[model samples]
Target: MALHLFSSIRGHRNQINALSRVVARGEPGHAYLFEGPEGIGKDTVAQALLARLACLDAAPQAADACGACRSCAALLRGEHPDLVRLARDGATIKIDQVRSALGRLRFDPVLGRVKGLLVESADLLREEAANALLKTLEEPPSRTVFVLVSSKPQLLLETIRSRCQVLRFSDLSPDDVAALLVAEGVAPDAARVAAALAEGSMHRARSLCDPARMALNDEVARFALALGTAPPTDAAAWIEQIAERRATLAQAQGADSDNAEADEEPAARTGKTALTREDLQWLLDVLRAVLRDVVLCGTGIDAASLPHARHAAALHAMANRCDIGRIVAVVDACQQLEQRMGINPNPRLALSALLVEAGLRLRAT
Candidate 1:
């Protein structure tokens, strides 16, 4: 027998069991809100639930879909007539897309007993689109199920959220993430490192496995340590170095044409190349992780527990050099900078100020 879809997914056993029970009862709710952290398998679980609902051979109380069946084959081919998936076209799901999908859901199932509308990144639904979705959720059609998946569910309309049967998913444990990566042929050491930095997000873990990203992580660790010892006057110079490193990483990653266009657009309009908010945010995240490790080391945590265990010596030295209070102040500054990045037009300037502040805090101790 072929492997069932549910069996391939890792974590979220409680959510899966709840969904399975509903499937077994043959009375799945019309609308479901599957909300969770990104890359924790919410989408995968939603797809599996839909697959089981559509599987012709699925029996009463069956735990999962018959993976070898015709319906399962169609789903695997992305040709399932009864399933309609909606994702962001560019940035938001426009009214037109919602209208189009709603039109399809109005029809009867083409190949199965039920039709499924899986809306990925449902929070990206524009105002008009969300209103249109709200109407459908209020009075959903018979034999149709709607699964709205989002990492940021608070952005969803209250009416829409209230109408759906909400299911919350938690992040995967680091060991679970590492095990999954190892199953996918990642080396044990690399998988462990990626999992530690992933913060329970499998998506981030996979990205961290990229050779370029791994190298960047090392650079970030070194930069964070250097910042702790560097003078406030060097903040501007360090910011410039960060920009150069970002450019190198972008080049190595073969950034897609869309990102390339985005990068070019800003440069053309401003006549100066600046790090995008996303770039700065990623750097901040790395810095935050390093600061966290330093704090943990200072608190007498084991090296194995740190995210950057390979940099244990440096982290320990930094931890010993600066008290927890000073390191925490720097971490707080990094977080505040992250929160203000959206409104602050000059991210580089903000980052420089943060580093200078961090330098002052660390040097004084």
Candidate 2:
């Protein structure tokens, strides 16, 4: 079967064409930093650029990969010897990985004419790893291309950032995300809801389609709504319930790791933890959405403009109970929780603190 190459990517035509022009002119840069928010197509564009560089028919003239060449086939199978991809190992990309990858760059292309290195989540590279990568970027190898994909490009070292051509990617519109989801067979209503919640990320829009994820978001949003009406005792109980669930999940995950086979399918492996930082972020995102709706409702914004249209009743009720000032305060607290979650804070404590604070503020209003 022929390797599948990107024919079209939503919201990235300008960036794609710009890189394609570079390839067609035979003046592609040695290093490019594709920076943007998650799911904004930086990685996708990088892959397309790499495919174009590696494609025999596309090189030196064409703007896109042919997708039928042996190089494209190898790329699809991850068997392209000249192309290297580096991802985070746990939390950071270590110095050793960068050193090895850089060393490989010094060698002649193993199979294809162009050597490509793609480093995902480049912001997660450790200081030593960044320094190591910087050396290679400063003096790149011949016929070699390096692409760094990062959502948090500011976290990268200043010296490293200065060494590469930076391409900025903008967020996709909700309509764009919804159109893609509908094309993928999602119901139009569900697709719109997911896109609205996705905050310009198709990656997040896909996650929102997962029943488990949506259920969790719904439960969290309901909890946020209850804060205005539930008693103090009920709020404490809710916190305890969340803590218990986290602990239970942690124990199950530990057991699964100890007993599961190395070859176990990820879907077959049970006991995925729900209290991860990412999960907490999602929870906060849901809360933020609800708080936003409340603010909108309080300020007499049109109901059609709200993302959580299904929860309009609850949102409007909350809006009636609290003024815009109190709602804004809660939203600010939610934002703080998001920042804290990113910095390795304790999940249970951080979540509980935010919920409790939100509850207190809501009740005071």
Which of the numbered candidates is closest to the native, going by highest lDDT? 1
* Candidate 2 pairs with clashing backbones: none
Tens-digit per-residue lDDT, 1-365, candidate 2:
12334567777777877886788787788899999987766777788788788787775666767767778878878678788888888678999999887777788887666889999989989998888888888888899999999988999998888888999998999888988899999866567768878888887788677564555566767787777565663544565565356446445544543211222233211113344554566567778887888888888986556766667788888888876798898888878768765454365566676677777778844
Per-residue lDDT of 361 in model 2: 77
Give lDDT per model, in order: 0.80, 0.74
- Alpha-carbon runs more than 4 Å astray in model 1: 1-4, 36-39, 90-111, 123-139, 151-162, 170-209, 226-233, 248-281, 298-300, 316-365
Q: In angstroms, how far off is 308's CA in candidate 1?
A: 0.9
Q: Score every model by TM-score.
A: 0.71, 0.64
Alpha-carbon RMSD of each model:
5.2, 7.4
